[model samples]
Target: MKKKICVIFGGESTEYEISLRSAASIINELDKEKYDIMTVGITRGGKWKEYTGKVENIICDRWYDDSLKDVSVDLGGADGALIVYGNGKLEKVKIDCAFLGLHGANGEDGTVQGMLKLAHIPYTGPDMLTSCLGMDKAYTKIMLESAGIDQAKWVTVNDYDRDEIMKKVVDAEEIFGYPMFVKPANAGSSIGIGKAKNRDELMSAIDNAFKFDRRIIIEEFLSGREVECAVMGKRGVVRVSCVGEIKAANEFYDYEAKYSDKVESKLIIPAEFKDGIEKRIKETAKKAFIALDGKGYSRVDFFVNEDDGTVKLNEINTLPGFTSISMFPKLFMHEGFSYAEILDRLIEIGME
Candidate 1:
């Protein structure tokens, strides 16, 4: 019997469209002989809907032309099967495990993971604690630094006091100097990030960042090559993918550079590095993953300072992009793993 794998995507997040792209890629690569794939779409408003056909078709071909109607799951039902109703009829669908492709808040911030845990269903990617920690930039940094990882100097601010935030910004300027990066501590997709080159820009960036999240993180901008490593599996047997370098066309790698083709950002698989740099980066990436108690898979980013030959930890994406053109799959592909093999490994690891 084929195991029923529910590939969940779309949520109330800035990365909703990105998640759809990832879902398409995964569904296309999943081995049909081994698993029964079910495509589940969650709207931006959090409504659960069951759709027909392959996940790739629904995602890439935009086949969601007609709504499959709304579905309700009776928690009391056996094995938590979803009760689908439409045209005055009903059916129940049982889900064995879910392959989550949702990104950003509500989905990636441990909410969905916690619900799945309570539902007694196994799912892919990190557990609740790791997901929550990885979602919050400020807390993640604290944990990383405490574990002796070299990360950029940062200060966090909440909505408590504007005056206090101003004072902190002044102190940050004094300590970290000019050209700082201000970002929302809990948001992803670089949705609310700004580069502050002066005091005025700093204040504006803070205000802009606060618009998206309650907590804002301001850090010193380190100029270097932006590199990332993809990690998979649990502790004691974790595997790291080849390093990939990101070259953003914009002043900083913002939303435009990430999703839009207008902004030119090149991805270099097996990034060019000096002797021992790649090995050191892989080692540090694993350390950072262990530091946060990460599980399943995560992409650890870094900034390699060419001038001083130093590597600084950037941030970790617990659920990184999985589109065919995305870096995560590209890295593994460059390392001799095909897309289908990557998907199989993720599902295999996820089941564990």
Candidate 2:
């Protein structure tokens, strides 16, 4: 029997457009022979609808064209089903599992995971607590600290008071000096991230970052090569993939450098590093994932100081991107898993 799979995409997230692209890619690769596919799209305003349009429409941003039926997970029921109501009728669509093609905000920060947990639906990626911990950079730093993981020095700003913000700015400057990275504590895909070299730029970056979330993270810039590793599987049985490096065309790997076609970015898989550096990074990747109680999959990033070969842990992305240039799949594909095979393994893990 073919299993019915619900591919959930989009959300009230800054990465909504990226989510659509990732969904389109996954929907295209899902084997039609073994699973029945269903797509649900959430609009920027948080409206949920059952999309029956062609997959290409999703990438073209036309998936919302025409009338689409209102759809929602049946949270009140024990069965893993979605309720679609429109045209004076209600239909129940049972799903065996859900592919969470979502990023940032309510979708990746455990909101959608909580809903699926209530609906008794198994979904790809981490559970509620893990998702919450992974999405919030402040909390992720806390977890990493507790695990004895070495990351860049950072200060978290949660207070919105003018005086408090200024105080933090002063403290950040005194501690880390200039040229810092400011990012929203709860955003991903490089959204709401700014690099500031002076005090004026730092203030502007903080203000702009706070616009995306109530809290923000300020970190001293670390000069090194940006490398990443892909991890999957549940606790006690995790798997790690080859490391990859990013050579951003922009001043840094901002959103544009990551996704824009106009910008030139280079991705080096099986990144060349000194002996034992790659092995140590892979080991740290597994350690960090297990420390966070990560499940399903994640991409752990790091910064390698080329001079002394010191590795500093970067953030862990619980639901990494699936876009054409995404490193998650590319790293695994280098390990001999086809895109479809990767999705298959994730689904199987979610079911288990």
Candidate 3:
């Protein structure tokens, strides 16, 4: 029997558009001979709909239509099912597994995973705790620190009041000195990330970051080569792919530089590294994945200090982008897996 695969995307997160593109890419690559595919889109307003539209519509932000059926997951039954109800009609669609093409916030950070768990449906990516930890930069850092993984020095802020935020900013300035990077603890695709070279920029950066998440993280700016490695499989038996480097068109790899077609961002596969640095990076990547008790797959980022070759762990993306230009699939492609093959492996692991 063909496996019934539901590719869930279009989350309420800031990375919603990226999720659409990622889901379309995955849906296009999935073997029609081996699987029965379904697409579920979550609107920005948090409505779940079963999208029966062209993949092109997903890419062009035209997937939403009146034809879409209002949907919900069946958490009350033993059989894993998706409940589609509209116009006084009800239907149940059995899902063998869910390919979570979601990024950031509600979908990626454990909300959807918790629902799938309650429904007893196996889904791609890590479990609820791991997803929550991986989505929150503060928790990721805490986990990495406990594992003794080398990373940049950082601090987290949770207070929303302007006076309290400014005090925290002063403390951060004293600790990290001049230039620093501020980002939301729970955002992705560089949605609310900024670099502040002075106190005014720092305050502005904090204010902007808090707009996306209640908590924000500030890290000391480290000048290094931006590199990343793709990891897969469950904890203690993970596979690390060859590294890739990102050459951002802007000062940093922000949301626009990451997704916009107008900007020219270059990605170098098998990114050049000196001597044993690549090996160390791959090792660190595995360590970071294991630290999160990662499952299915993730993309681990890092910064390789050009002057000293120090590899500082950056972050782990549990549900990395699956777009044509995404680093995760591309890095695995360099490691001898085709895009479809990568999906096959992920689905197989997710089922397990």
Reference-based TM-score of each model = 0.94, 0.98, 0.98
**Angstrom error at residue 152, model 3:** 1.0
lDDT of 3: 0.91
Query: What ranges in model 1 sit over 4 Å off?
Result: 53-66, 72-74, 77-80
Give stretches of model 2 more than 4 Å off: none
Residue pairs with colliding backbones in model 3 are none
RMSD of each: 2.0, 1.0, 1.1
lDDT of each: 0.85, 0.93, 0.91
* Ten residues in sequence with the least summed lDDT for candidate 1: 58-67
Task: Give one digit per residue, the lDDT tens place, for model 3 in 98-214.
Answer: 999999899999999999999988899999999999999999999999999999889889865555776777778888787999999999999989999998898899889989998
lDDT of 2 at 328: 99
Residue 7 CA displacement from its true place in model 2, Å: 0.4
Candidates by lDDT, descending order: 2, 3, 1
Task: Supply candidate 2's per-residue lDDT for 174.
Answer: 89
Tell me model 2's lDDT, rounded to 2 decimals: 0.93
